[model samples]
Target: MTSPYPPSTSISPSDMAAGAKKPTDLPQAQIDAIIRTKRKAREPKACYPCHARKVKCDRNLPCDGCVKRDHADLCSYERPSKKRAQAFESPAGASTSSAAEPTEYYSYDDIPSRVKPENTHPGPDHLGVGGRVSIARDEWDNVRSRLKEMETTISSLRMGLERAEESPAVGPDSGSVQSAEGASRSKGNSPEREGIHAANTFGKGTVHLGSRSVMAYILNNKSGSDQLQALLEGGILPKLGLDNESATYPFVDLWSSDMSSFDISAVCSALPADGQCRQFFYYYRDISGAIYPVIEDITKFENDLELLLAKRLEAGGVYREDGDQAQTPFGTSIAYLGLLYAVLASGCQSSDLGSKERELTSQVYVCCSYQCLRMTNFLSQPTIEAIQTLLVIGNVLSYNMNPGISYVLLGMTLRMGLALGLHVESSRFSVEERYRRRHTWWSMAWQDSHFSLSYDRPSTTAVSQPNIAYREGSQPGDFSYFETLCKVISLALEVVRIRMLSPNAHITFSSFQEYQERIRQIMIEAKPYLRDPQYCSSSTEHLERVVLKLHSSYFCSELCRPSLKPSAGRADANTVAMRKDCVSNLVTTVDAYIELHNISYHAARSWIALQRAISSAFLLAVVEEAKSDSHVLTALRRLEGIIAQRASSERAYDNGDVATSNITSSDQGMASYDPVTGATNPRGLSHPLSMLPLLRDLAPNLKLNGPNL
Candidate 1:
């Protein structure tokens, strides 16, 4: 192309001698390139909004500065047109005269869009040995997209398969799946589902009382379901001469305004006489205390009790004006009274008194204790004493067949302990104080773990906190049973976390074996404290050993029981061995519980002991091979006989003629007894014996000749 500009009017002599080209003497292409480079260099890279506002721009499609300024719609990077370049070249009127009308400015929307380049080297669509087939870029892209979609589908299916493998499938024989499908179909037929309506009513939510709970486990078994259904349909209670209405006991209304009225005189009057109080305190110390050991200083507690009673006597059983001043620390505090009363109630409950007297006395004291606790505002200002009272109350309730209440109360108690900083070790505290805190914290944790395991619920107390080093006893060589119990419970809680709370969804056989080995090691380490003659010399120590032994076996059996489930599938040699071991441990647990009961009826009255026994008995009854075992039959019969005798004694007492009742049992001298509490009907067997019917059905050959009650 020809040059568009004229030559320069002047040139340097040095440039001419060196033969370098002048700017005005260059070719048209070189001149145009120089103009384009200068134009490009001066052009703005930022959007017009950012450039006009004089702010830094990210230079994105919609520059950040423009977006922040709310002018993203006008954020254009368009530069001035070539008209400006032409005007620059012809600064005089020569070019301006030709376009003298007006200058026109183009908006961003007026700018034409750039055209995309075509693919000149599109690859072959298919490759072959002989030749290849050429295709468009769009066709290759389409093929890639389909392959990506298929890959995604395959990945989703693989994940679903893995999840299905982790969860147990419902067997065809089990109607649960069919029932669920039927329920879904029924719901689909509802009018509410046909259209979207502004409904005011809310649907009821389903409650999942844990699938692993003992009751749920039994209900899941086919035979157990049939037996329980038959009993329900046949009106077992009516046949046993018990009214359905009589079975339900009215719960004590703690929230009532009447219960809110706290009377110091009433509490003092409700308490047993001095000697009787001493006896009851001793009972708690020997029975519940031996197991939990929440009370750090028994002597100090007794001294405080004496002071409280003496002050009450001096005040003539009324609130003394100077009582708070006289007993600055313990005696005057409402929490202390609650603690004392709770201990007394626990003792009274464990006593050999007649069922009526025991229940009445314990209820009175329990009410007094609760009133005192309410008055103290324990929820807001929980103390060591208040927590102690709750623990005792929970212990009493657990044995009284109120495990649900106990579980809830224990959860509250654990939270209270955490609030009191009992979980943390404080150097400012005295050695005795530190020990008390440790004992209280671990006691709550141990109880919480047991209840959570029994209920198949998550524990409120986690093992990760506190970070406090556990001492077996405050003093050396003490051989604390509470410590042993805590250790075992801690190990069991670990297994629960792995098996239930783990992300893996299911426990493998190898993992189960690993947990079993860990439990075995813990038991081995605890054997010395459990079996040493020095520790087991006293009666309390002996009882502790027996209870510990029972719990140890129960935990072992529980670890194995899941393996025996129908979901566990066919049994290998190892599984068979584990089943045998489970049966053996269950038998041992039952035997130990029977022995514990024989030694001290109060000791065996614990809900945990009863639960373990019942669970083991039912498991034995369910296993085909175990049903025919003579030893199992003998133990179950003995347990049944004891339950029947207690029920008959209770019936006789209800008749209001205890002396005239024809009771030929060996313990006939003892008053009418009810080992389990909270019976539906006072004249019938307690809830614990409701499972006996199932046992009877399973072991028909064995003579469990106990009455229906």
Candidate 2:
């Protein structure tokens, strides 16, 4: 080929073709290389609207500035013409595969849209995941809204109660409403008027919030500024790492004239512009004064409180059966229902958690126990319908995936079940007088007439009948009232948690150890207490009952069957005579309660075995008291046989050997949520050793089985 160049630079084709393979007349390779280079160099730079709107435009994806914003997703690049694209197509002019290989095409934003001066994003949830900086946003939005509504109801009722107290002209309805509100508020916030509003998230004392102690939240229709300040210092915008949850509502601090001005706008202002980065704090509570440590060395503080309530009952103490008075914080009927809901919530969520997690168990001991102490007013009222409603709320919350609320509900449920039993065992109240309290929370919430499995209502189901553990009524300090006593343990455990003294809890003689360790060492420390011949071979029993409160959608399932119960005579009516576990003296009062109500002999045996396990604990406590006063020791000495007999009962090891409940037609006490027990540790059940059985029974799938505790 002749060179195209002019004579000065031209060379003959023969002379230039030495290294060129075929001396091609055309430069097809040179053209392909140029096209490849151009394609590799392409860059997207459309417009700002396209970048922000997440759509690609002919102009480009994200220009240089979009890249600077760290939003790589906004980048759209320069493109080649369609003709250029055709250059790479297969010789056949089509892709052979039915489906194209998964190609990684970068997506882009829209072209310039209508411009606006307003902020690009709407409220909190306006942006896509790739373009936002949201942090631990309170997924409690729905909860917050519900809390707001509840607060409104509480405020109105509280006003009525206070006004009623101040004026005889106040009607019962107003007084009752006030009472209800006050109790409920106390549960979430605190009853301690002297404390600040939420200060710390992990539960601690005040942080000297920037303002001089001023009253803010309690002010009527307060400003958002002051509210923000308080919230900045307090509100617990309850965030538990879930989506769509509302923040924990800021509690009204009526007691503090020092902290003033609780404004929501201010609270919002306090929040970071990026709602996720920060959380607003709410409330200032003196945990020592009102909080219950549901999570502690303790497994079920509710059990202790229940025992205490039962003791009171045996002492002939009269409790309000159908009023707000039944709603006391530590062991109120209403709060008790909350405990039942908590139980169901945790039980269900735990099963649903897929791994049988113990998170709910700890939270139960800490968060749920607060009900017994904070809601004293409600417990005092004992409003049956009110108690039932709380359970329904628990059930509703149980469906939530939020573990925090689930934990709180579980604690509430345990307490509620016990309350049901205490009320049933209350001699001072007639069954009809408390019938309203007996209805299940589901029924109360919906007021549904058709709540049943088969034709029978939950309370009347055979398999759902009460266990026999609730049948005994013995003595003051007798462990029989364990259900009520659980409330007391709840209080004690809270005290330990707040004080950080659980580590110093006394387990045995001169032996101080962490409360949890002490609990773990039950068998070890128990050796001394069990050495007494009294606990061995004695038939004395410590019983407790379980009423399968829930019936499956079908009543015939194994979970709902009630087996034949032991036929024990009211044995000795005088067993109702309360023996003083304190110093031998005149009657402080007879404290007698049933041990087992309608459970099987084996279940009763398990209860009895548990008592033996804790025999040393009771003896240890009594012996310690004896050191201070020999007279007290004398009382302990006289009760040896009875106590020993109870211990023997605890030796029953029914684990897998015990039969599943059999639904006998004669079964009674159905749909009951209470459990009765004999060996009520005035200090709470021997460190929750019983929880082991419970954990086991409830494991894998727990909805069908009742736990050992």
In terms of TM-score, the best-performing candidate is 1
Model 1, range 582-603, lDDT digits (tens) per residue? 7888898988877666556566
Best candidate, lDDT-wise?
1
lDDT per model vs. reference = 0.59, 0.27
How well does candidate 1 match the true structure in TM-score terms?
0.64
Which residue segments of model 2 deviate by more than 4 Å? 1-196, 199-344, 352-386, 389-428, 431-472, 476-481, 484-709
Looking at model 2, residue 75 earns an lDDT score of: 45
Which parts of model 1 have CA positions greater than 4 angstroms off?
1-208, 229-261, 323-330, 426-428, 463-478, 503-529, 532-535, 652-709
Note the clash tally of each candidate: 2, 169
Please write out the lDDT profile of model 2 over residues 230-281, one tens digit for every residue.
3233332222111112223212222333343322222212211211111100
